[model samples]
Target: MAETLRNTLKAERERLDLTQAALAERVGVSRKTINTVENGVFVPSTILALKLATALDRPVEALFQLDDSGVSPKQDT
Candidate 1:
């Protein structure tokens, strides 16, 4: 499996008291896009990620991270 992009978009958005529609407007995307991202149904583009971080007043790394669940097990050499 490919590494998944984990995010704390929903928590950050709530921390800032912004609704999905509000955050989407700030990022120039549809609310559905934000919802999908929050639900891990979509991986946002780098630009989108930056926009979200900026709007949420957070670093991109704070909002997103790589999950280790997709890592393959090491094989014997």
Candidate 2:
């Protein structure tokens, strides 16, 4: 079984009226980094995730979650 990583970074960032570039600056990353994460092309590191959560005034869990939809049940032999 496999788990997926999901996030609400764009929504939260927008709620705070922040542009991707602005949020990136706040979190010490590049705008492309933020875009990548928002678009699910990249997974941020623990430090980056925490920094984003803090900058957006949200908890880390609120920003990211483990999605189990990708999990598959074991098949009997």
Highest TM-score, which number? 1
- Model 1 misplacement above 4 A: 70-77
All candidates' TM-scores? 0.87, 0.86
Candidate 2: residue pairs that collide? none
> Can you write out model 1's per-residue Cα lDDT over 1-70, one digit (the tens) per residue?
6678899999999998999999999999999999999999999999999999999999999999989786
lDDT of 2 by residue, 1-77 (tens): 75568999999999999999999999999999999999888989999999999999999999999786866677999
Q: Tell me, by lDDT, which candidate is best.
A: 1
Question: Local error of candidate 1 at 17, Å?
Answer: 0.7
Instruction: Evaluate residue 61 in candidate 2 and report its C-alpha lDDT on the 0 to 100 scale.
Output: 98
Candidate 2 residue 76 C-alpha distance from true site, Å: 22
